[model samples]
Target chain A: MIRPGSTLGILGGGQLGRMMAMAAADLGLRTHIYAPERNSPAFDVAAEHTVAAYEDEAALVRFAKAVDVVTYEFENVPAATAAILGAHAPLAPNAHALAVSQDRLMEKTFVAELGIATAPFAAVAGETDLVGALERIGRPAVLKTRRFGYDGKGQVMIRPDTDPAEAFAAIGRAPAILEGFVPFEREVSVVAARTAAGAFAAYDLCANEHRHHILATTRIPAGVSRGTEEAAFEIARSIAEALDYVGVLAVELFLLTGEDGERLVVNEIAPRVHNSGHWTLGGAVTSQFEQHVRAICGWPLGATGRLGRVEMQNLIGDDAHAWEQVLAEPGAHLHLYGKAEARPGRKMGHVTRVYPESD
Target chain B: MIRPGSTLGILGGGQLGRMMAMAAADLGLRTHIYAPERNSPAFDVAAEHTVAAYEDEAALVRFAKAVDVVTYEFENVPAATAAILGAHAPLAPNAHALAVSQDRLMEKTFVAELGIATAPFAAVAGETDLVGALERIGRPAVLKTRRFGYDGKGQVMIRPDTDPAEAFAAIGRAPAILEGFVPFEREVSVVAARTAAGAFAAYDLCANEHRHHILATTRIPAGVSRGTEEAAFEIARSIAEALDYVGVLAVELFLLTGEDGERLVVNEIAPRVHNSGHWTLGGAVTSQFEQHVRAICGWPLGATGRLGRVEMQNLIGDDAHAWEQVLAEPGAHLHLYGKAEARPGRKMGHVTRVYPESD
Candidate 1:
C-alpha cells in the first residue's frame, strides 16, 4: 500500500497537476511531475520532475517505477503510455477510462450503452459520414473531432445554411462526431470520486457558465430541483461504476427545461479534475484535489460537505491581472498556477469566493 | 513592488517553511527555500531550493539576488545571513527583529522596554553572574542559553536548595539568562501578522499544552476573559510595531489567574510561524501561512475570523502511525511532514479538527 511517505507520479504539468501535487504534499505524499515543458507549473511544487515526451517509453517506465502509484492531470494520456505505466505501477482511473474519454465517439457510446442520457451523437469518419450524420442529427449540430479537442478547439458548429463539407473541412475531417444540439436551459456538472473498493462520493451539483467555449464561472447549489440534483448524482455514479474509476471525475450535463419538466443529459465526461470543481478548495470540507489524492491513495474519502454558498471564476488570460483587486477582497481565496506568461484563453489562475450559507 | 508573480525566498527548510512555500504557491508567488539539509521538507513544495550553510555568503547573496523578497521560517537565523539577504532583496521582519528573537536576554529586554509584562529575568554570563542573578531572581527559575535553544533544550530549571553552580554547569555556563518562573493558569499564544505598511491582524488567542517542552495541543478561544484576549492582541501589536515587523510572528505568553483576574506575561517571541498557530490552517478564514505571505508581500491583511471551536494536536514521533485512523475520521484535516523517519518528539504531522461553534 502507498503510505504517506510514498511518492506519487503525476503526468501532465499544468495547473491541475500543480494543484494535485500541492494536495498530495498536504497528505504527506511526495510528488514527481512528468511533462515535456521546462516551466511546467506542476514542476515547481513536485519533489521530482521528468521533462520528457509522453511517447518516451523509457522515461514513462522510469517515472512509473519511481512512484508507488501513478495518476495523470489530463485524460488525453495516450493508450500506450497508460499501458507502459500500468505495467510498472498502479494507475488510477484505469487505462480503460482513458481510452473511453479520449475519443468522443467512444465516450458517447459508453454512456449511451450504460443507459445514461447523452446528446444524440453519430460517428463521422469522413466527409461522406459527416453528410449522412448531419442529415440525421439535423442542422444546428456540433461537429467535433473524436479525439484531441478541448477549449473550443478541434470543433465547429454546423448551421442550417452552413455547408457540411466546409464543416468537416473546418475540423480537418478527423474522425468526427456530429452531436445534435440540445437546447439546454443551464449547464451544470457533478464532480465526484470513486475508489477501487466501490466507495463513491459526489460534490453538490454545480451550475457552470462558459465564455467563448471556455469555462468561466461555477456556482454551487446549482439552481436545480432536489430531484434533478439527485438524478445528476445518479448519472455520475453510473459513469464511475462503468469505468471502475478511482480518483475524482467530472460529468458535465445540460439541464433541459421543457413541457416535460427538467431533464439532464450528459454533455461531456472529464476523467480528471474539472475546472468547475475548483470552488471546493475553499467552499467544501474536503477539497476536490485532496479528495482525488485520497481516493487514488486508497484512503478513506473525506466528507464532501459544502462549507457555504460558493462561486469560482477562472482567471483566463488578462483576467489574472485583477489578482491585486481579488487579493484585496476579504474572504476571497485566490489560487495562481505560477505560469510565467498569460496568453489569451490560458488559465493563469482562479479566484473562489465563499459566503455564509445564509447569503 | 513584490507582486503576485514575484519570487519569495525563505531562509529555512523545515515544516514551517514547507507550509509557507505551499501558501506562497497558492497566492501565485514562487518560493525558493534555502536550507543546509539535503532532504529538507520545504524543498518538496518550493519552486527552487539551495542546500548551503547559513555562513555561505556567496550562496546567500546569489539566493537573495534571485528573488524579489526574502522571509524566514525560524528566528535563530544568523544576523549576518539576514543582512546579506536584505542587502540583496527586501527582507521582511527586519534583522533587528531576528537579532532580538535569537537571544533570550535581548528578546526579554526588548519586550520589557516596550512596557510588556515578562517574567522577571537577569542576564547570567558566568558563575559569579549566575549566583548573583539567582539571589536577585530567587529560586524556581529557568536558566536558558542566550542563543540556539529550542524545544526545552539549553535550559535547566532551578528549584529551592538546588546548587546554582551545578545548574550553570549543566547548561555549560554559556551566555544565559535566569527567568523567575511565573505560576500560570495556562500557556497561550498570539499568532499575528504585520505588514511593513503597518497593517496588523491577529487570530484568536489560542491556549497551548506542552508535553516534554514541546507544543502538544492548541485550543483556540483560550477561555480567557474578553479583556485578557484584547490585552494579548494589544501586546502583540505593540511588539510588531516596535520592531517594524513584517510577516507572521508568535508571542508565547503565560496566562495567570489571581485576585486581579487573568494576566498575561510574555514568555518568548518567535519571529516566524509558531506551532500553536497551526490550528489557523483549517480553523480560520485566512491561515497564518497565507497571512505571513501576504504581510511580507506588502499586501492587505486578510480577515482573522475564526471558523469555530478548533483544536490542533501534533502527531509526534510514532504517533503518526495512526494516519489511517485519522484519515478515517470525518472533518479532520491531517497534515503530515514528508519526513522519512519519525524520531522521538519529532513533529511528524498534525491533525486539526474544527467543530460547530457550540461545541
Candidate 2:
C-alpha cells in the first residue's frame, strides 16, 4: 500500500491534474506530474514534474519508477503509454476502463449489456454504414466520432433534411456512432468513487447546464425525484463494479420526462474526475479529487455528506474577470485555474455558492 | 493588490507554511516558500521555493521579487530578513509585529499598553535583574528568555529555595523576562484575522492542554462563560488594531476562574496561522489559513462560523505512525507533514474531530 509520503504519478497537466495534486498533498502524498507542456498549471503545485510527451517511453518508464502508483487525469491516454506505465507501477481504473471509455461505441455497448438504459446507438464505420445507421436510428440522430471527442467536438447533429454525406465529411470520415436523441428533460450526473476492494461511494446528483456545448453550471439537489437520483447512483455503481474501477468516475445521464413518466438513460461515462463534480471541493465532506486520490492509494473513502445546497458556475473566459466581485460576495468560494489566456469558450475558473438547505 | 495568480512568499518550512500554501492554492494564489532547511515540508506543496539561509540577503531579495507579498510562518523571522523582504515586496503584519512577537518582554508591554490584561512581568537582564524580579514577583514564578523560545524551550520554573543565578545561567544568561504566573483554570486561545482595512474575524475560543509543556490537544466550546470568550476576542482585536496587523494572529490566554468571576490575561501572541487554529480547517465555514491569505491579499473576509463541536489533536513524533488507523476511522480528518523523520517532540501532523453539536 502507498503510504503518506509516497509519490503518486499523474499523467496530464491541466486543471483536473492540478486540483488532484492539491488533494493528494492534503493527504500527505507527494505528486509528480508527467506532461509535455512547459510550465503546465499542475506543475506549479506538484512536488515533481516531467516535461515529456506521452509517447516518450524512456520518460514514462522513469516516471513510473519514481512513484508508488500511476493515475491519469484524462481517459484518452494512449494504449502504449498506459502499458508502459502499468508495467512499472500500479495503474488505477485499469487499462480496460481506458479502452471502453475512450470509444463511444464500446462505452455504449458496455452500458447496454449491463441491463442499463442508454440511447439507441449504432456503429458507423463508413459512408455506407452511416446511411444504414441513419435509416435504422432515424434521420435526426447525432453522429459522434468513436474515439477522442469532448465539449461537442468531433460530432455533428443530423437534421431530418440534412445530408448523410455532409455529416460524415464534417467529422472527417472517422469511425462514428449514431445516437438517437432522448429528448431529455434535464441532464444529470452521478460523480462517484470505487476502490480496488470494491468499496464505493457516490455524491449527490448534479443537474448541469451548458452554453455552446460547454458546461456553464452545476446545481445540487437537482430538481429530480428521489427515485431518479437513486437510479443514477445505481447506474454509476454498476458501471464501476463492471469495470473493476479504482478511482473517481462520472456518469452522465439524460432524464426524460414523457408519457413513460421520469426515466434515465446513460449518456456517457468519464473515467476520471469530471467537471460537473467541481462543487464538491467546498460543498462536500470529501471532494471527488480527494476521493480519487484515496481510492487509487487503496485508502478508505471519506464521507460524501453535502455541507449545504450548492450551485457551481463555471467562469468561462471573461466570466473570470469578475473574480474580484465574486470574492466580495459572502459565502461564495472562487477557484481560478491560473490559465494565462481567457479566449472565448475557455474555462478560466469557477465559483461556488452554498446556502443552507432551510434557506 | 495581490490578485488570484499573484505569488505569496512565505518564510519558514514547517507545518504552518505547508498549510498556508495549501490554503493559498485553494484561493488560486501561488505560494513561494523560503526556508533554510533542506527538504522542508512546505516545499512539497508550494508553487515555488528557495532553499537558502534567512540571513542570505541576495537570496531573500530574489525571493521577494518573485512573489507579490511576503508573510512568515514563525515569529522569529530576523528583523533584517523582514526588512530586506519588506523592501522588495509588501510584508503583512509588518516588521513591528514581528519585533513585538519575537520578544516576550515587548509583546507583554504592547498588550498592557493596549489596555489588555497580562501576567505581571519584569525584564531580567542578568543576575541582579533576576534577583530583583524574583524578590518582587515572588516565588513559583517563571524565567524565560525574551526571544527565540517555543514549546516550553528556554524557560525554567523557580520555587522558594531555587538559586536565581543558576536559573539565569540555565537559560544561557540571555536577556529574559520573569512572569508572575497567574493561577488560572485553563489555557485558551483566540485565533483571529485582520485586514489592512481593519476588517476582523475571529474563530471561537479554544481550550488547550499541554503535555510536558508541548501543546498536545485543543478543544472548542472552551468550557468558559460567554463573557470570558468575548473578552478573549476583544483582547486579540485590540492587539491587532494597535499593531495595524494583517493576516492571522493567535493570542494565547490564561482563563482565570476565581471568586471574582472568569477573566482572561494575555499570555503570548503568534503573528501567523497558529496550531490552535488547525481545527478551523474542517470545523469552520472558512479556515484561518484562507482567512490570512484573504486579509493579506486585500480581499474580503469570509464567514467565521463554526461547523460543529471540534477537537484537534497534534500528532507529535511517533503519533503519526497511526495515520493509517486515523484514515480508517470515519469522519476523522488527518493531516501529515512530509517530514522524513519522526523525532521526539517534532510535530509530524494533526487530526481533527468535528462532531455535530447536537450529537
Candidate 3:
C-alpha cells in the first residue's frame, strides 16, 4: 500500500489536478504533475512537474517510475497512455473505466447493460446510419461526437425543422451517437468514491444548473425524495463496482418528474473529479478531492456527511473579477484557479456559501 | 494592492509556512518559500523557493523583489533580515513587531506599557544583576534568555534552593529576563487577524494544554465568562494597533481565577500564526492562515465564526505513526507536514475534530 510519504503522479494540470495536488500534500504526499502545457495551474503547487505531451512514452515512463501511483484529472486519457503508466505503476480507476467513459456510446451501453436507466441512444458511423437513428430517436435528438466532447462542444441539436444530415455534418461526420432528449425536471449528480478493497462512500445528491452550456451553480439537498437519493447512490455504486474503480467518480443524471412519479436517467459519467463536486471542498466533512487521494492511496474513505445547506457558484471568466467583493462578504468561501487570462467561458474560480440547515 | 495571481514570499519554511502556502494558493495567490534548511516542508507546496542563510543580504533582496509582498511564519526573524527585505518589499507585521516579539524582555515591557497585564520582569545582564533580579522577583522565578528560545529551550526554572549564580550561568549569561511566575488557573490564547487598513477580527478564545512545554491540545469554549473573553480581544487589538501589525497575531495569556473573579494576564505575543490557531483550519468559518493572507494582501479579513465545538491535537514524533487509525476515524481532519523523519518533540502532523454545537 502507498504510504503518506509516497509521491503521486497526476496526469492533467487543470484546476482538478491543482486541487488533487493540494489534497495529496495535506496527507504528506508529494505530487508530480505531468502535463503538456507550460502554465498548467497544478504545476505551481506541486513538488515536481514534467511538461511533456501525454503521448511521449519516455516521459510517461519516467513519471510513473517516480511516483508510487498514478491518477488523472480528465477522463479522456488515451488508452495507450494508461497502459504505459499501469505497466510501470498502479493507475487508479484503471484503464477500462477511462475507455468506457471516454466514449458516449460505450458509457450509455454500459449503464444500460447494468440495468440502469439512460437516454435511448444509437451509434451513427455514416450518413445513412444517422437517418436510421434519427427515425427512432425522433425530433429534438442530439447528435454528439462519440469521443472528446465537453461543455456542449462537438454536439449539434436535431429539431423538427433541422436536417439530420446537416447535424451530422456539423460534427464532422465523426463516429457519433444520437440520444433522445429527456425533458427532465432537474439535473443532479452523485459524487462518490470506491477503493480496491470494495469500500464505497457517496456524498449527498446535489442539483446543478447550467448557463451558456457551462456549469453555473450546484446546491446540496437536491430536493429529491429520500428514495430517489438512495437510487442515485445505488446507480453510482453499481457503476463503480463494475469498473473496479479505485477513485472518485461523478455520475450526472436527469431527474424526470412525470405525472406518475419521479425517475432518474443517467446523463454522463466522469471518471475523475467533476466540477459539480466542487461544493464538497468546504461544505462536506471530507472533500471529494481528498477522498480521491485517500481511495487511490488505498486508505480508508472519509466520512461524506454534509456540513450544511451549501450553494456553490462557478466564477466563469470575468465573474472572478468580483472576488474582492466576495471576499468581503462574511462566511463566503472563495476559491480561484490561478489562470492569467479570463477568456470567455473559462472557469476562473468559484465561490461557496454554506448556511445552517434550518436556514 | 497585491492581486490574486501575485506571489507571496514567506520567510520560514516550517509547517506553519507550509499551511500558509496552501491557504494562499486557495485564494489564487502563488507562494515562494525562503528558508535556510535543505528540506523545509513548505518548499514542497510553494511555487518557488530560495535556500540561503537569512543573513545573506543578496538572497534576501532577490527573494523580496521576486514577490509582491512578504510575510514570515516565525516571530524570531532577525531585525537586520527584516530590514533588508522591508526595503525591497512590503513586509506584513513589520520589522517593529518582530523586534518587540523576538526578545522576552521587550515583549513584556511592550505589553505592560500598553496597559495590559504581564508578569513582573527585570532585565538580567550579568551575575550581579541576576542577584539583584532574584532579590526583587523572589526565589520561584524563571530565568529566560531574551532571544532565540522555543519549546522550553533557553529557560530554566528556579526553586527556592536553586543558586542564583548557577541559574544565570546555565543560560550562558546572555541578555536575559527574570519573570515572577504567575499561579494561573489555565492557559488560553486569542488568535486574531488585523489588516493594513486596521480591520480586526478574533476567533473565540481557546484553552491550551502542553506536554513537555510543546502544545498538545487546544479546545474551544475556554469556559471563561463573557466579560473575560471581551477583555482578551481588547488586549489583542491594543497590541496590534500599537505595533501597526498586519496579518495574524496570537496573544497568549494566563487566566488567573481568584476569590474576586477571573482575570487575564499577558504571557507572550506571537507575531505570526501560532500553534493555538491550527484548529481554525477546518473548525471555523475562515482559517487563521487564510485570514493572514487576506490581511497581508490588503484584502478584507474573513469571518471568524466558529463552526462548532472543536478540539485540536498535535501529533508529535511517534504520535504521527498512528495516522492510519486517525484517518479511519470519521470526521477527523488529519494534516501531515511533508517531513521525512519523526524526531522526538518534532511536530509531525495534527488532527482536528469538530462537533455540532448541539452534540
Docking class of 2: medium
TM-score per candidate for chain A alone: 0.99, 0.99, 0.99
Stretches of candidate 2 above 4 Å error?
none
Give the distance in Å from residue A5's predicted Cα in candidate 1 to where it truly belongs. Answer: 1.2
Q: Please tell me what DockQ candidate 3 reaches.
A: 0.89
Estimate candidate 3's alpha-carbon lDDT, on a 0 to 1 scale. 0.95
Taking the candidates one at a time, how many backbone clashes does each contain?
Answer: 0, 0, 0
User: Over 4 Å off in model 1, which ranges?
Assistant: none
Question: Highest DockQ: which candidate?
Answer: 3
**Could you give the TM-score of chain B for each candidate, in order?**
0.99, 0.99, 0.99
lDDT of each: 0.93, 0.92, 0.95
Q: Write the per-residue lDDT of candidate 2 for residues A107-190, one digit (tens) a residue.
A: 999999999999999999999998988888896789999999999999999999989999999999999999997888888999
Q: Estimate, for each residue in B262-357, the C-alpha lDDT of model 1 and write its tens digit.
A: 999999999898899999897888999999999998888888898889999999999999999999999999999899999999999999998999
- Model 2 CA lDDT for position A79: 91
lDDT winner between candidates 1 and 2: 1
Q: Model 3: how far is A23 from its true place, Å?
A: 0.8
In model 2, residue pairs whose N, Cα or C atoms come closer than 3 Å (at least 3 residues apart or on different chains), thus clashing, are none
Each candidate structure's TM-score, on Cα atoms with residue i matched to residue i, is 0.99, 0.99, 0.99
User: Candidate 1 has what TM-score?
Assistant: 0.99
Lowest-sum lDDT 10-residue window in model 1 chain A: A130-139
